[model samples]
Target: MRTVAIIGRPNVGKSTLFNRLVGQKLALVDDRPGVTRDRREGEAELGHLSFRIIDTAGLEEAEPGSLSDRMRRQTEAAIDEADLVLFLVDARAGILPADETFAELVRRSGKPVVLLANKAEGRGGMAGAYDAFSLGLGDPVPLSAEHGEGMGDLLEAIEPFLETGEDEDDEDRAGKPLRVAIVGRPNAGKSTLVNRMIGAERLLTGPEAGITRDTISVDWRWRDHPIRLFDTAGLRKRARVEDKLEKLSVADALRAIRFAEVVVVLLDATIPFEKQDLSIVDLIESEGRAIVIGLNKWDLVADRPGLLKELRADAERLLPQVRGAPVVPLSGLAGEGIDRLMGSVVQAAEVWSRRVPTAKLNDWLAAALSAHPPPAVSGRRIKIRYMTQVKARPPHFALFGNQLDALPRAYTRYLVNGLRETFELPGVPIRLSLRSGKNPFEGKKKTWD
Candidate 1:
């Protein structure tokens, strides 16, 4: 994999871009500059290419031998070691003298550079993007790292620099083991369910809350397909977690959810849909992982008539974000409903990875828009010109149109629901990104197809 270092001045959204590419919040981010003091690295994927991405501390001139100076040295070392450099500049802030100085440093390294004009989501940053030509590092790629815009353009820009030929490992990705994480609240029988799944005492289980204080993984085969199971410590309310170790464990559980392709949210059948349970499901949805709600300890529940149907209805009403997710009733200790749960998991994974053809997507978009035309905003009708699935580990789509920033949230939800139903993408989080017209000053009118 090619190594690409993100080199820029302070607060240019390098860490945000890094986290976006890595598909995990591995780096800490804040409004304040200089939040990062060391070089952080992670594997990143863009379209079909995968590479190693390095997030370096903000490049700032400081006193010799000072902390800031050492950080700068580390960044310079990263630039020297990287096969290419992603030079980011705050498009909203425009080009700064510091940016000029840093460009010279990266230019002197003689490495391939992709100038990123970050924060160029709307028209506000376009002027700066045009001014970036003065930096003499080729044309700037307008990007919005926080909103995940311009990623398609970035992928095209860097594809030639990175290796794209598939290797033996890449060939195995289709047959690779599916990763599934079991997460829930404390005393929710997470460990019990994990032990029952693998049919072995691989994890410590008990009635005590917080018995498992770490995220543990187990490898097993189910019905001939390889599977990796991640059993995470039960997550409790943030207010209830005061211990430092518990905090670390919770963070680890969160990371496991982000890494997993499918997440089985194990809920106690006796007390289902607690605030923490809903919050955990929300986290899984936000992370764009396929979801399966496991109603554990079902054998202990007294009510058995129509309770499963009621619970499924409640899941739809309470968690519409992951609407139609499979809800399995099982007793982990008794090993009941394990097959059904695994079946749901495998199906959810397939749906999460599903992709729709652009022709079909646009056909659906036209019908949906015609059925319920977008409401006029400020007396002008919002025209949705095009729609296409950009990538699908969670089925993210891009919608191009005029006045898209003014598109109402309710309307977007309607379109998301339509896509879900029309394409049969149930239970998986569907990402719909809106891309508005370019800066009007470019002497070109926005065209619709």
Candidate 2:
């Protein structure tokens, strides 16, 4: 796919535009300027054109020795890599010196530049739109990225530049399934375990730690489900990491976590309840991905019965975010319990991908609310009227109710726990959002009346 870079000064709605084009929140947006420090790439489609859109850091001429200089370098690198550049300027602020400087930089690159005068919604942007032509890039495309206005003109400008014809192997590319990352701390047997599961010498196996440097994603199939398995470098504490490659490897693992649908966090059986392990679990949960825990090198541990009880307790105590998650014990080197591990993965993934019907979900909600009524606030009883599964990769629900503003966190947990138990959803993160208001149809007269 052709690469299109969105370049602009800070707070110019570049990310907002990027997200609108990509149809996903791949980049974080906030009122704060320069929230984007890294170059984010996502697949975007405009009419019949599909391309990779890169959201780059805002370009600023910083002093020779400064962080902004580093940011400038990153932006320049993105500009170098892009096939087309969308030079964004704030229409509300008019043409600033930074805009002029960046316009020159874009010109120097000798690439096709589309000057976008963003925030051109009101009369305030009229003068800026007129002033933008002086930059000599081209007639500015007046756009309000936040409101999604003037997209037709933007598409019209780029349509001519788009390379014609589709690839012959488009079906194969479209059919590629999700890539999963399996990661954990040292001696977690991540590599050995992966080798065992693939039934090959896919990765090096040893008693030593930190054998994997680069994050290696191996493409394979399980139960006819196509998967690219990423075996990442074992993450050590930041203080203990001294090598540059290890730092890069750690970043690569994090990138993998961001991209993957399912992340298997392998744990060492000997010291499974470490703070670092908990941190990894928190990261996966925060990323809103499906997770499964594997207690590896289990053959080395003694007191199997007692250990199982303790492990369950630890999982409950430390990782309540993913309650009722499946924890399987396996020795990667010996190929023990490998089938159960794969089965758990498939089961967890199915649950993660599950979408509860609106009727069935409301039914579940009614029973749950009846069992444990919501707490009253200021003598007014809160009533949950309806519930709907808004979206799911790991299922997310939106609850509409009366006086739900006063709904207690404990009650929310109760509903979530009930939903998990009732639906048999295990080892996947679930989200519940509460919205309070009167039912729109409540005041309406019946047709018979």
Candidate 3:
């Protein structure tokens, strides 16, 4: 598929156009300049044409090795990879020196450029749109990305460059990439593990614990299988997270976990099973995300045998919620056991997406009921009429029965464990919802009051 990159100086609505093209707010947009420091991408469609669109950071002139300079380099990389460039400018702000500088750079690249005069909703921006001809890119396509106007002309401008053949990305058509979120408490080497897994320094890592602030996603292929990985900020205790920015970062990380198909909780080998680490696992289980535990920094362990045994015991005793989750020892730094970790991820994903046939489910339900029937509530036998899977992906089941709300938590755990064992589900959270069945004799009159 062809790629289009949105580029311009700060606060020119570059991200707005990118989001409009993608039909979703994949990029974070704020009135503040430089809210977007990293490039994000999404597949977009325009009329009968489709392409992969990139949202790059606002261009800025900075000295080499500076943060601003780093952002510029990322934008340049995006431009280099793009088949076309959507150069956006705020029509209301008119032309600036910075815009001219970046326009020169875009012209130098010699890629097909569509100069977009965004914020041209009214006559307020008409003069700037007219002045855009001075940039020497082309006739500016006066557009209002915020109000969703002038899309037809914009589409016509770029449609000529698109290849008319069908999209050749087979992986996208066959199935969606597995969405995995690598999460843990601060400094568990989550970013490093991602870098090692992709065999590239795609993420910025340092000795700092909370370097990653946003939930950044990247497309990667592992063993020819496409994987979309979200690298998130390290979560600290809520009380310890005092800064407002850190709070927002934590919130973003939680969103990633909620949307992820599988979550790998990276644990520091020396401090495996810390209170925070346990809490992170508990959160993943509660969210019903398929989970795998990667004990990172295995190279640092002095007594591997003793520590591994202790860790296994702790997982059994403490993480009963996900009883049989895979706990693979690995060193994210040394890349040891990374392959095993990926295998565990694949296995967990299969279990997470498992769907049980209704016939087999009822059969297992009967056997489970016969083995250990639900105890009576208030001396009345709680009759469970039937059970059926409601959905998969950390499978959810709905059990119809009498007085289900009064059923003991222990009984629910029994059914969950039975379902897990009988269905061969491991390392994935199971949800069993109790729903009261309607009484058949409800409409009948009560003769004796």
Candidate with maximal lDDT? 1
lDDT, model 3: 0.86
Clashing pairs in 3: none
- Candidate 3, residue 202: the lDDT equals 92
TM-score of 2: 0.63
Model 3 residue 85 lDDT score: 95
Native-to-model Cα distance after best TM-score fit, residue 193 in candidate 2, in Å: 1.8
Q: After aligning candidate 1 to the native by TM-score, how far in Å is the CA of 309 from where it should be?
A: 0.6
Residue 158, model 2: lDDT of 83
State the displacement of the C-alpha of residue 37, model 1, in Å, after optimal TM-score superposition.
14
Superposed Cα deviation of residue 234, candidate 3 (Å): 0.5
Q: Count clashes in each candidate, considering only residues at least 3 apart in sequence or on different chains.
A: 0, 0, 0
170-244, model 3: which lDDT tens digit per residue?
A: 545455467789999889999999999899999999998899999899888888778899999999987899999
lDDT of each residue in 293-313, candidate 2, tens digit only: 889888888556688778988
- RMSD (Å) of each candidate, 1 decimal: 8.0, 13.0, 18.0
Per-candidate local distance difference test: 0.89, 0.82, 0.86
Residue 300, model 3: lDDT of 95
TM-score: model 3 vs. ground truth: 0.63
